[model samples]
Target: MENEQIKTIFEKEGITSEIQCPKAFEISEKYGVSKMEIARYCNKNNIKIRACQLGCFK
Candidate 1:
């Protein structure tokens, strides 16, 4: 998906600056994107990952 689309999804999901780990994985699966890609996008956009299941993010 495009960046705009992802942004829209984020907005719809109430993700402004932070997102839960499960939600991120859900988005990844729903959009057919990799978890690493989602992590990269979050990192690049200054969006923090919270409640990480695997302790990947803090």
Candidate 2:
């Protein structure tokens, strides 16, 4: 992940700070949504960081 791109993802998501072990599933699961939904969201937003990208779909 490029430095600027990482910054952009956080700022775009209104999460402008450091977070820890922050898996997308944590947010989606609480909404009764599929983890894959988060993956798609990231893709749509152009946040291509591999750690955030996932293979959670069946």
Number of the top TM-score candidate: 1
**TM-score for candidate 2, residues paired by index:** 0.42
lDDT of 2 by residue, 1-58 (tens): 4434544555564643322225445544444445555445455556443343344522
Model 2's alpha-carbon lDDT is 0.45
Candidate 1 lDDT, tens digit per residue, 2-53? Answer: 6677788888888999998999989888878677777777887899998899
lDDT of 1 at 1: 58
Error of 2 at 17 (Å): 10
The deviation in Å at residue 21 for candidate 1 is 0.3
The 10-residue segment of model 1 with minimum total lDDT is 49-58
